[model samples]
Structures are given as structure tokens and as C-alpha cells.
Target: MAAAEEEVLGLLVGAVDQGTTSTRFLVFNSKTAELVSHHQIEITQEFPREGWVEQNPKEILLSVYECIEKTCEKLELLNIDRANVKAIGVANQRETTVVWDKITGEPLYNAVVWLDLRTQSTVENLNKRIPRNNNFVKSKTGLPVSTYFSAVKVRWLLDNVKKVQKAVEEDRALFGTIDSWLIWNLTGGTKGGVHCTDVTNASRTMLFNIHSLEWDKELCEFFEIPMKILPNVRSSSEIYGLMKVGALEGVPISGCLGDQSAALVGQMCFQDGQAKNTYGTGCFLLCNTGHKCVFSDHGLLTTVAYKLGRDKPVCYALEGSVAIAGALVSWLKNNLGIINRSHEIEELAKEVGTSYGCYFVPAFSGLYAPYWEPSARGIICGLTQFTNKCHIAYAALEAVCFQTREIWDAMNQDCGIPLNHLQVDGRMTDNKILMQLQADILCIPIIKSSMPEATALGAAMAAGAAEGVGIWNLELDSLSAFTMERFEPQINAEESEIRYSTWKKAVMKSMGWVTTESSESGDSSIFGSLHLGFFIVSSMVMLIGARYISGIP
Candidate 1:
């Protein structure tokens, strides 16, 4: 009782969760790992083309500021001192590239989102540069050449946007993922802002060496990016800098992680083979692979799980992502006119036993992980006269489960250890129907965590683990806020296999349903095909000649 009282003095930690659709701030009592006060605001996405997605960088930062201010006001209303918030951590949407003028702090263009397919032609050109070896940079980067990463988006911005080009030429442009953008502004914007990104965010960029823990200059040249524009890569935990002008101005902005990496920490998947599947705007299934960087032969991404301190050994994980999950529900509500609310899809799906000979493959921005097919587009196959709105809704929900099953299969092949029970946390997990479907499809038990804000909790955990001054220790058992609900497979293995076989066929049909021209060829300053080929060949020749001259290994 005495220890509890002493611990309650000033041990709250604040987390800023800047996600694809919303920005939020939550305060957690480190003594009990329970949420105290929080606020959230929605952010809009601009879609100018069929397959493009963009967000305003200024709006994103403003959302963060408003969330902080509102959450602090709530803390005062509850009679809790805001000074109890020791540190602030940020967990942001990864791979969304943002560029700004360092001198003016103005965004050069709309932030190109992670799922944007505007770089499809750039990816096609990049793959052609390697002559059938699409994974040329995958050996060092542990990622395939896809429009899913930040480098391609950055390359697209430089090639297409005039303002970005001018800023880069003047040496006043700075580039980073959403986390770095948040950190730079939170620390002090244009006035001595620390431009840095954590290991997890850097690993998603395709410009970072997973082994060396630094930016890969050679790959930067291949992508035609300037190295000087990149930020300093840092570990996930430590005092990044002090919050510049918030209720917690002088407080240290200590922890940072990409959303999925933060979810891994929040799920407490500390041991190798412990995996968690986060169901968010998309589905990301990450299996902790421990310290060694285990590159996957099974089409999974090897990425940094987290680096706790400045000198701590990095932990690695195999990540496989699904491009569309919850967003599919939004599409159904707004575009298709099927459901009234996001949660109503589950109620509609429960009306049908199955999809009734239908399958919806939401390759809306194309497939990710296990099958990096950029040419693929959304498809709803096997539709019969028996199918109706309910069946379509059922198929859509099953589509999410089937995609996760594909990733789960790939993770098993890479790790050689099938998870006993898949741990799940995110907004989509609230659908008990989907959770059961996930278990039924994968033939594994599903353990859904009670934490609604697992990603934010993960960031808060990192913030409180900062050096000697922080309150929390980086351990599994220290958190008392976790509770679980177990979901066992209701269907037999044979039934699951038959349904999965149908899903496989639907996936194959979705592939190559769209044009491979990849759009915007004539308007791109993105290098002509012949010019790009010459550039690659010349760069390789220069690299070989330099190596020979230096006699370096």
C-alpha cells in the first residue's frame, strides 16, 4: 500500500498516436498502466486520382497539438496534475513520406500516404533497372521494391513536384516519415528542431541497412535521393528532445516508433516467435524474430522491432501487411451504400452463414506481403445469383480474415514456428465475428487483448523507459492493464481448407486485373526508361571502379 502511494506521485506518461485516419493523445498512469485522460481528432485524406492518397502535413501537426491541449484540459477537470505527465512519446503511421522546407517549415507537397499507388510506374522502372531481379536491394534492406515503401514515394515527389525540386536544389529540403515530422515540430519546428527518425520507421524506408543500423547511401543513389535531406536515425527509446510549446513544453519527447512496431511493444511480444496481428486501417502481422535480422524467403519483410536505448542491441521482426481491412468497411459504408456504420458490417455478416459462393479480394491499392503485386486491383469473384448485400458484406469481412491467413501462412514458413494463439489488438478486433473468423480461417486460437489503444500504450511504455529518470522498465510483467479473450476455431480443418482454397483462387483472379502502365508516364520528370537504364549501368560501373581503386572489400 505504501509502495503504491509513493508510486502514484508523478508517474503518468503521455502518448501521441498519429495514425493514418486520426491523431490522438492519451495519458497512462505508469503505476497501473491504465488510461487516465485522452482526446482524438480526425484527419482527412485527399484522393486526386483513382489510386492515390494524400494528407496535409500541417493539418496532421495541428491535430496533434489540439489533441494534446484537449487531453491536458481533461486532466485538469479530473483534478489530476498535468505535471504528472513525465514524458511524451509519438507513434505515427509509417512509410508516409513528408518533405518540408527547413528554412520556412512549410510542407513542399501533400504527404504521400503509405498505400498510395502513384509510384507504381516508378516501381516498374526500378524493377526494370535490375532486369528481372526485383529484390536487388532486398538483401541489405530486407524489403522488396514496391510502391509500399517511403523511398519510392520520396522519389515520386522529387520527380513530380516543382516545389520539392527547388527546395532540394537550394539544400533547404528535409525528408522524413510521419514520426520524424512530428518529432521535428514537437521539438521546435524551424528553430533548432531535431530531425530524426527511430529504427522502426527508418527500416520501412528501403534506405536503411537493417544490419548496420544506418542509412544506405548506395541504395539512395539507386533511388535518386539526396542523402543530405535524410534525418539522423535514432533508437526507439531515449530523450529525443523536449516538447517545444505544449502544456508539457519542457517535458522530454522521449519515445518514438512506427505504429506496428509500437503495437508489438504494447502487445509485449518480447520473445522470439511471439507474434501479434494489429487490425487497423490495414492489417499488419508481426512476429518477433529477436536480435538477429532474419531475412525471409517466404515474402515477409524483416524490420526493426525496436531499439530501447542508444547502445542496446536491436530486436528484429518479420512483418507482413494487408493493404485493406477496416478501410474496406468504410468503402462499403460510403461507396457501396451497404452499411450505415462501420460496426454494422458484422451484424450484416452474421445474417449469412458464409459468403454463399462469393469472395471479395480488396486489392484496392494492390496486394502487399507474400505477394507484392502492384498491378493487382480490387475484385469480388465467385459471385452468383444467390449473392446479395448480406453475402457481399460477409465476403468483405471474410476477405480481411483470408488476407491475414495468407500473411500468417507466410510467417509460419519463414519462422518455422506456428504461433500457438495469435495475439490481436486494434479497432477491428472489436468485431467478435471477425475475431472468430480469423481463428476459423487460420486454424489457430485468437487471443484478443482488451487494450483499445495498444499502439499508444506501446509508445507510452517506451517513453517511460527512458534511461535513469523514467518510471517504467522494459519488461512483459510490469504492465497490469492487459486482459485477454480467447477465441477458438469453430470450424473444422477440412472446412477451413476448402474455404481457403476458394480464397486463393479469388486472389489469383485479382492479380493483373488492372493496367501495368502504372499511370502518369508522360508527365513524370521521373527519368525516361532509357535514361534510367543508363543511370543504373553508369552508377554500377562507377561503384565497381571506385571499389577497385580503393582496394576495399
Candidate 2:
């Protein structure tokens, strides 16, 4: 009977994926690599002002709690013993800032989402005070002085929100990303809740010194953020605390990572030069650089991939990002009313075999990696009378692919090795046409896993490993066999080059859209070398096309 019970109580782990748009709870069976039970709930985004995206911290917590309850109820309905769930791991949207009361754990203001650009003015002001070199902060934290990071968000809150300032003055303020907030509540809330963040999440905050693996006092002082309010940093995989409140109460809360890093682990990108691109609200391309933090000469972030346990060497990555990917599809559906649903964009795009001379750069919040042009704005060029919504939809999808190609070129140059194939996951991978387009443009096979929830699976893997679940062990290579589809390049190199070159022209038009007279902003030149990466590849083709078209040398 005991042995029978042992078989029934097989190794399992739970993952709470708190994303930009939703919260989810997923349970995984480590032995079979199966997602046993899961639940998800959409969270609302509030845009109080232009370029400001916020979410209620209370709502986020409630949504997460509800997801856990519903998921555990599903497990009960399936007659699985809840006790088998040994640990709960978390993967969250990184850089979203939340400042709460240290004693009450009540948020002073709504969470400043990673996408929020409210700190643009703050960033400009801070830049003057910091060392004049643009790479000064990057040398210490591997991130540029930009509004995209948590430190700037924290600074904005400290300056703007009176409640946040009061909390800080009263010594009651607590700062955290979504992962830290969720973990604190999951552990015990205000009552001895462990205040901590994993290394992956910490790396996103410009406050953290990636080399020293601690919150830099200098950065904290520069931002006027009190160190007392910051969460303690820890390894990506470890028993941070026991789940004090939940269906699986007392189960150890063992693992946590920023969503992009989690997807890297979930896709099993464990070696140098191996990479994964998550097509989420934004597209994130991460290439693992093993133990070394390979600073990008190209516009890419240096980040921690994951640290499995305390005292383990941290695995680092070179990250390039697109400010918009799936979000562009959402904008077309919600804002433009071009499609009824995001999935419909794919079919609509197929209605037109090509973009029909249209090229769209969805630089809604400006371009991110490689370009790093915050002043840039969205642009759609080469539109003709023949072009319609179908062409526009196709162009939108192509924008995602083209942006990816640009980043991949940077990763190739930074790592000094061409990636033969790309591993992909997230909401966007469901579109077969887009995946094919990605392969065609990049000229590499795009591999996607059998399970789409790579981010959640990564968190579960970390939890299971910490709990000594043999099946969740990282050493096993069998899990790599779970790849469901591989997209191979279908277009000829010449045609791919032509499409890419046209896209480049559209992006060039998008650059420097915002000038000093329009808004008190300065422009920075886009970084690239004529000898290497995407620029060279696209430039040669464009130059050749120009000469051929004009009948010149």
C-alpha cells in the first residue's frame, strides 16, 4: 500500500507565470515532462496618460491567488494528491516596479510596467548627473541609462508619487519586481515574508551590479532609492521560503526567474552560443554566453541567464529585444480594427502573398536592440494604391521577423559563431506563417517545443531540481527531444535579401522621428559596423540593387 501510494505521489512542481497581460498557474509532472493541470487569467493594463502603462499591484496579487486556487482545484478534480507538489516556482515580467509598505505590504502606487515610458524625462535628467560616458552605467550594470530599467522607474515613483516618498521617509517602503512581490505574498505577506529577488530578475534592474551580484550602493544613491527598501537578491533556483498561503501551503517556494531567462532555461539553452527567442508582448532574443558576461559592442543587454543554486557560477547571456512583437498584432486588432483577433492577422496576411511594396516598422515606443532609438516612432512606407489591410497585416508580421533578423545578426557577431538554428516559444509561435517568415528572413531553421509554455516549464524545472526530483534533473538530454516543429528557410537567399533591404529603408525612415523642438529629447546614433552583422548583409544587397536598378557600377 505504501509503495502504491509512492507511485501515485509522483514528483510534481507548480509554476506561477505572472506576465505583462496575464497570470497563470501550471503544474508539471517531472517524470513525464507533462503539464498536468493549469489555469490562466487575464490582467488589465491601465494607461493613465500617454506612454504610461500601469497595473494595480493588488489586482496582480489577487489574480495570481485566484489562478493558484483554480489550478489546484483542477488537480483535485483529477484526483491527484496535492501533497505531491513539492515546490512552487515563479517566472515574471521583469523591470515592472512596485513600491509597497514594508510593514503592511500595501502598494503605494500601481506597478509601473516595464513598457511604461513615463520616465523619459527622468532618464534625460539622470543622464546629465551620471558619468558622461554612455557606457559608464553599462560597464557597472550591463544596461544603458534608459527609461526601460527598474532603477529609472523607481526614481520616477520616488519623485512623482507622494505616497511612495512618504513610505521611503518613514522607512516603510519595499521595492520589488513582479517576481519579488508575488514571492513575498506567496511566502507570508507582511508577516515574515521573505523579501527577495532572483538573480535573473535582479540583473534587469540597473541597480544591480552583475559582476558583484549585489545591488550597487552607488546606483541606489544615484537613483535616490534607499537600499533598505530593496529586496534581497538570491539564486534563481533555491528554497527561498515555504508557501505560507495557498492551496499547497507549506510547500517550498524554490525557484524564480524573469520570463525571458525562464524561457531560455525551459528551452534548455544551457551551452554557449545556444539561443532562444520568446515572442511575447515584446520579442526577446537571448543567447547564452556560459559563465562570462559578454558585453555587446552591438546594442544588446548583458544579463544573467540563471543560477541554479547558491554558490553556483552564474550563467550569463547577451540579450537583444524588440519593443513590439505580438503587441503589434494586438494594436492592429484593438487600435486599428484591422483584424477581429490576433490569430486572424496571420490568415489576413496570407490573403496577400506579399506586403505589396508596403513596409511597416512598429516602433510604437521606439526601437529597442541594435537601434536603441527611443526617439523613433512607428512608420509604414512604400504603401501604394494597390495596398490594403491585407498587405498592412502582412507587413506588420514581417516587421517582427525583420527585427529578429537584425538582433540575430548582432548575436552572431557578439558570439563570433553563426547560430545554425533558433529555438522559439511564446504566443507568437502559434502562427505558422510568421515562423516560416522568420526562417526565410533569417535563413536558419526555427525550432519550437512540443509544449508552448517554456517559461512556466523552466520555473517548474528549477523547483523540481531544488526538491531533488530525479526526473527534473538538468543532466537529462531526453527533454531536448520534445521539439514539435522545425521551420526551414523556403525563400532563396536573393529574394530574402531584397525583402530585408526594403525593410531596412523603412526602419531608416523611422529613426530620429522625435526632435528637440517637438519634445526636449536628444538623439543618439544607431550603432553598427559596415564590416559585420545585419547592416553589412543588408547594405551589400541594397547597394547591389541600387546599381542594378540605375544601370551604374
Candidate 3:
């Protein structure tokens, strides 16, 4: 009788990891704590204009539902009952803003991607309106006054989109990050959807007060947005609602996190000072700070890491965001035709001993963290007659490492305690050459997890934890599920500093290349004159700087 009961009630948890370029669903067996089945589908990102990135909100929902269906089919094929899937968790791309109609559950427009720079002028406008010293928004919200956060995206929609403005006036506007949108739709959409967002996702919006963990009315009023449209803030790991539609209709939607926060939890960085860096389409570096909301003197954003329950203490983190990381490699593949496949970058880069005086600064969507330069564009400095595709490939990989090193420097300043090692995950960590470069550049250990797709696993852990089968389970040690490979620094500190200095000079030259006058004049002089001069001078400067710093006469 016990054996029959065991077969019938085999428990499992499902995670929906909705990322910038794709949607994936992963199912984990609670008893064994192992990934049983998974399915993924790429999301199409639409570029309607230069610097404007959008995604069809409805399509995002449809893709997620499809992933769930496919994953469930695989589960059934394995003889795992779909009904046994006890809970569903969600981890999504943060700050990708979505607004919709309250009554009909229809998206007003495409989701404004977090990487979109359409709101730059709007952010500037807001800054001009408010006094510089009195700009409490940053201190209160833990985010800078930039287009990266969600409130400006909301403001842009209200100011530009007629449909969104009309809906706001009619009190029919409904706003959410991707996770909240998915939760509302999965829990029955228009019928009786739960309108809510987790603390982690909410913290990225720039409208949420990090100290109080609530929506700031002053911020809403300042942005000219209606608070009626916002989702209710909730704990990261708790039952938000049950799925009333889709593949797992009856299962409870138990956990939700911003992808980076989910990665933190997935890495079991529950203790303060533990850090994790996720290398996805973009890279996000988050350092756990426990309960204290340590306001970063540096440009790093303070954010809610995760809240397991309503009564559980909130975990805060200082985060450094990289707008371009793995995406640069993708560009080399599709845009430049440097390599046929992303994995091919490793072999091609290995062909060269170093970047060979080349440095690729991928500011395609502008620089994030430390610099926060919205006007900057991508630049490849130090290219020469000898520079080959292999050199460019290596530089592209080095760009990721250099950006991460900058973030680590900021985090060290803010936290006062340096990270012992960087816990790395995501598809990009598979690059052995990149990992070694990361270690040498940062002058620190790079700990790569066996389970590279940690965003989904973190989501799964949150859901399973809510139901008491997570990290707390004695038999299932969270670390046991993951084996780790550590890469230590190989080069001397002087060499690392020299390389970093050259990278910094390249970054400095990349900035202010597009000025307001040039942009407003609609003249190619912005790129033709300023950008060309800067690139040439920067290339020469890097060569000189590298030699000087390395003590080479």
C-alpha cells in the first residue's frame, strides 16, 4: 500500500525561466532533487528603431505556455504524472516593463525591454525637473536615475503611447514585469488574476521603496503614472496564486524572482557577502548583503535579493549590471560572421595568446554599472593590420571579463569585504578560455557550477522551499546537487592592473562620443567626427598605457 502511494504521489516542482532571448521551463523531482525534464523556446526581440528594443507581451505569454506544454509532455513520456507537479516557480528578465488593459487582459503595446534606451530623454527630463541634491529617488530606491529602471519606461508609455494614456485615465491600466504578467495570466488572466510582483522584481522598478518594500506614491506622481496600475508587492517564495489555465492549471504558482536574484538563491548565497555572477544575454553580478540595504556609494544598485515568505527577513544585494556580455558573442556570430556557433568563439579565441592589442567595448545598449553612460556606443580599439578574427574573438571575450572586474571593484568599495570567489553560471560559463581570462583579469578565483542553467534551478528551489523540499531538506544538500570547478588567477597583479588600465582608457574614450548637440542636429558628425577621432586616439592611448603600466620601455 505504501509503495502504491509512493508511485501515485511522486512530487515535483516546475520552474519557468523567462529570459531576454528565450523562455524555458524546467521540472525537478522533489524526492531526488534532480532535473527530470526541460524545454526551451527562443523569444523574438523586435527593434522598431535604433536604441529601442521591444517584445510582444502576448507572444511572451504564449511562448511560456508552450514551453510548459512541451516540458509536461516530456514528463509524461517519462511516466511522471503531470498532476504530481505540485508547484510552479517563475524567474524572469528584470525591468522589462509590460502594461495592459485591466478588463480584457490585452497588452497595450510591446514590452519595453530593460536594455531599451528610448527613455533616455525622459530620464533626463525627470532629472531636470527635480533638484540634483534632493534626488532622494536613488537613495530610497537603490537605483540610479537612468533608463534602465522600470518607472521611466512607465512614464515613457504614459507620455508617448495614446492607448496607455487613455487606459491610465480610465483606470484600466495594469503594469507588471514579465514575472507578474506571467503570474496574472497563468492564474486566470481576466477572470480573476492575482495582480502582484515579488520583492526582488519590484526592487528593480525604481518606483518601489526598498526600505519599506512598498510602491512609492511620490515616485508615481513624479513620473505622472497612476498607482492603480501597479502590481501588489509580495514575498519571493510563497503561493502567489494557482494556475487556472495552461498545462499545469491546478498547480500553485509558489515562487517568483528576477533572474539575477533567482541565480543568487540557486547558488545558495543565503549568507551575507556571498556573490554570484550570471552570464546570459547580459551579465548581472549580485552580492548578498543579508538584511542591510547598504546604499552603494558606487553606481551599483541596491536591490532585494529574495524574501522566502511574508514573515521571512528580506535579503538585500548590491548589484552591478552589464548591458552586453554574451550578446557580444552573439553579435560576432550573427552580425560580424566571425564564428558560425557561439561555442566556436572559445577555439577561435584560443588561437591567439591574448587580445593582441585589441579591446572590444560592447556598449551596444550603453554602459551599465560604474559608468552608467547612456550615450556610449560599441567600440573596438587597437585593431591593426595584424588583427584577425581570432583577435577580435578574444577581445569580445575579454570585454565580458573587464566589465565584470569593474563591477567587482565597485562591489568591494560598497561592501568593504571583497568576494573570495565569483560564483559563475549561465550558458556562457562553458567557455574555458573566457573563464581563465576572467580569473587572470579579476585576479580572483572563478567558481563555475556544474549546473550552468542556475536561473531555472533557483526558481525551482524557491518553489520547492516554499513547500518544504528545498535546501532545508536534510537529505538533499543544495551544494551536493552542484559540483564546482575553480579557476585561479594565473598572471601577476602588475600584468592584471596593466591590462585593466588599458581597458579603462578604452572605456573612457567610448564615452561622450555622442553629444546632445550632435544628436539633436541629426548630423552624422556624431559618429563620423567625434567617434572616429576618439577611436583612433583611444587605440594609440591603449597601446601606450599598456606598455607604461607593464613597465615595458
Candidate 4:
């Protein structure tokens, strides 16, 4: 008699995690809510010009396919059947948009990355047309008029790229953040792929209304984006469609969410007042504020935590964003060649106990959150001659910690109840030194996630929940005891305050560095030439468009 075959004990949910630096697919045993197999491949970011970041949309799609295939192979190795994957989920880097020809399935142009500051002029002109306050759209969209949002990035593509402009005018273009692009291609692409986005992803575009949970018409008109090109907005979890091909073929693509929001779900923060922080290429801290949207008086963003199903009530969150986190470590690796690998940062940082009065503020594109200063540039202040690259590395780590501190304080104020401990995840959470600093700087306990792949797991959970399967239940009893590790604050609040104040002095030095003259001289493609006439003409065009949109003579 043949030996009995080993049976896989749990239902599997596959997740596609497309992030800034890379794309990955992970499989989880939803019954236990544990990540079992995974694969990831790095995506190249092309900088054609200074302050410009682009990624080939096709390459991004292909990475998803490759990751899924490799991960499925790993499942087979463990005696698990790939056909057991109940559903597929997606967790993508929010605001990084892709526009493509709906019928041809061809991208109109390289995707304009979220961090690209080519929209500086677009932001400046839009700000001129709107109210003086930065939070002009906060009441409706819960976002600001900034380069980080998808609308401005899409606007830049519409105005600058001739092919994209023509496509838009002809009604042949379909605009989507990374999630929509993937789902479309995954389902059928040219052969009738579903073109829709989840509520969490839709909320980042500055086009979606937080209250009504639909795309706003006035915001689209203000951004000059036609409503037709936008995707159909849906809740975070539902049966959007089925996978067209691959090992998990015919499996429902049931869930989708932005990265940080996915982390919020994975952290099991379904209750109000629970908060989590993610340390990735950028840093994000989100505090669930329940059903009602709480607009931040401070510079934090109000965003959707998650909408589990069509029938589920919407959950709102107060989010604080940091523009650069792990990317700063990448700078030391790539730009300075101080270290050969990104993870080496921890060892070098451990050489010094602290930054030693030196501070490194990487406002490279510009600062996000509490200080919405777009013109700010990076600076390494208080640098004595004795300051080595080690000190710089140490300070770089401290910079991320300090930025998290700023966001944490802002969240506490908005929620009116302090978060006792921060639930933290992401690649950066691996560095114990950084975790300790985060705890010390924030003067709170830091609880690191047991699942390092919280973003992917969250998407998986969403997919599983749609099928009415086992997910990380909202109840604490359903959680795995190994799900977290707590790091207590080593330093007192006074010392933390003293260190943070000095960091503030360095931050002030970095602001207002990008004036018109500097911008014109540095990034000349936007202005064509550094002339007063060119700027005047641009302003005139903006005024004309603004007046036309408002129906004002």
C-alpha cells in the first residue's frame, strides 16, 4: 500500500505585496494567521532627471507574477497543494499611480512614483488656486494639496506627457494606483480585466470622499482629472474577480488595501484608539478613531483604516507620515558607499551610543506630517570635524526615530487618549538598535510584530475574511501569543525631550531651502529657462484654468 500523503492542515490565502523598493507575494495559513511561504524581487526605480522617479509599469506587473510562482513552488515543497489557495489579496504602496490604455493594456507612460517631486510646480499652482490653508481638501478627502497624493502626480502626467494627455482626451486612458493596475492585468488585462480599487486605496487619491465613500466630482474637476478614467471604488474586502492564470488560477482576488492600512489591519487594531507604526522606505503611524473621521488640527492625515466588506461599516484613522525612513539607510549604502548592505547600518550604528550632537534630517523630497514644508531640503547639522560616517549612520537611525516621535505626539493629541504602546512592523523593525531608540525617543513601550510580513498578512486576512474563513479575529483571544514583543523605554522622558529639542534646531535649518530661483536653476525642465517671463506666463495659464473651472468671468 502507498504511504498516506500528508494533508495541509489549514486554508491558504495568497497575498501580493507591491512596495516602493520591491514586489513580493506571500502565502499564509489563514486558520492560524501565519505566513508560510513567500518570494520577493526588487523593482528598479529610474531617475531620468533630478527630483524625478519613474518605474516601468510592465516590470511591476511581471514581478507580481514571478513572486506568486516562486511562492507556490515553496508551498509544494512543504507538501501543500497550490490549488488550496482560497483567494488572492493585494497590498501596494499607496499613491504610486499607473495609467494605461484600457483596451491595449499598455501603460501610457512610466509610472510617476509617489516620492517624485516633479509636481512641485503643480502643487504651488494648485495651492495658489485653493484656500491659504494646506488642509483645503481635508474636510472631504482627508488629504492635502501635496506632491505625495495620486491626483497631483496624475495631473503632472496629463500636462507633461503628450501620449498620456492625448489618451486622456480621447477617453482611452484608465488611471489607477498600483492596486487597480495589478487587478486589471491579473483578471484579464485586455480581455476584460476588472478595473476597480478598494476604499483604502481610493482614499489616498484626494479624489475619494471620506464621508460618502465615493469619488468626489468637484475634486476631480479641480485636479482636471476626468471621472471616466478613474477606477470603480469598492470596499477593501470582496470578490472583485478571479485570477486568470498561474497556479492559483480561478482563485478569487478578494482583498486590496494600501500598505500602511494593511499594517493597521494585520496589527489587529479593529478597536478604536489602537495604533501601529510601519518602518519601510517611509514611516507611517496610524491610530484607529472608529467610525467617525477625525480631521487632524495638527498636520496628520485622516485616512480609511479598512472597510472589510460591502456591508461593513467604514473605520477611520488619524495617520502621520514620514517621507523617508529606510530610504535614508539606502542613501548611506548607495550614495556614500559607507556600507555594502542596507542591514549593515545596525552594526555601524552600534559603534556609537548616540549621534553625539550631530543630526541628519533627510527631507530629500520634502518633509511630510506635522511640518508640511515642501521647500525643505536635507541637512546634517551640528557636525563637528570629529563626526565620522559612523556618527552619520547613528544619526540617520535617530532621524527616523525622531520623526516617529513627532507623529506619535500628533496622534495622541488628535485621539485625546494616549497610545500605551506602539505596535510596530516592517523591515526596519528587525534592527533592535532602531527599535530601542524608537521606544526611548517616544518614551513608550514598542511592541514589534511577530509577523514581519504584516503588510502581506493583512491583505491575506482581508481576503480570507471575505470568504468567511479564519482571519485574525478582532477578539484578543484569537491572537497568537507569539504575535508581539515589547521593548520598554530605556531612557527617561526628560532626556528624550532634550535630544528631541536639538533635533528640532536641525529641522528648522532644513526648511525653506527650495526657493523659485533655486528650483528654476536646479530643475530646468519644468521652467524651460530661468526667465521672469516664463514664470509669469505659467502663472497666467494657471489663473485662466482656475477661473474656467470655477465658472468665474
Error of 2 at 337 (Å): 1.4
TM-score for candidate 4, residues paired by index: 0.92
For residues 389-463, write the lDDT of model 4, one tens digit per residue.
676788999999999998888888888888898999999999999999999999989998677888998898888
Best by lDDT: 1
TM per candidate = 0.92, 0.91, 0.92, 0.92
Q: Which stretches of candidate 2 lie over 4 Å from their true place?
A: 1-9, 132-134, 467-471, 515-553
Off by over 4 Å in 1: 1-10, 131-136, 476-481, 521-553
Tell how far residue 504 is off in model 1, in angstroms: 0.6
For candidate 1, write residues 1-553 as lDDT tens digits. 2356446644789999999999999998786678899999999999776678999999999999999999999998987778878888899999999999999999999999999988887888888787455555888889999999999999999988999999999999999999999999989999999999999999999999999999998899999999999999989999989998878899998899999999999888889999999998999999999999888888899999999889888999999999899999988777655677999989888977688887888887888988999767676776544556677788888999999999899999888877778999999999988999999999999998767788999999998998854688776464745778999999999999999999999899877745545344423223222222244224434534434212233
Clashes of each: 0, 0, 0, 0
Give the range of the ten consecutive residues with the poorest summed lDDT in model 3. Answer: 544-553
432-468, model 3: which lDDT tens digit per residue? Answer: 9999999999998999977776788788878877744
Candidate 4 global CA lDDT score: 0.84
Better of 1 and 2 by TM-score: 1
**Residue pairs that clash (backbone atoms under 3 angstroms), model 2:** none
**Residue pairs clashing, model 1:** none
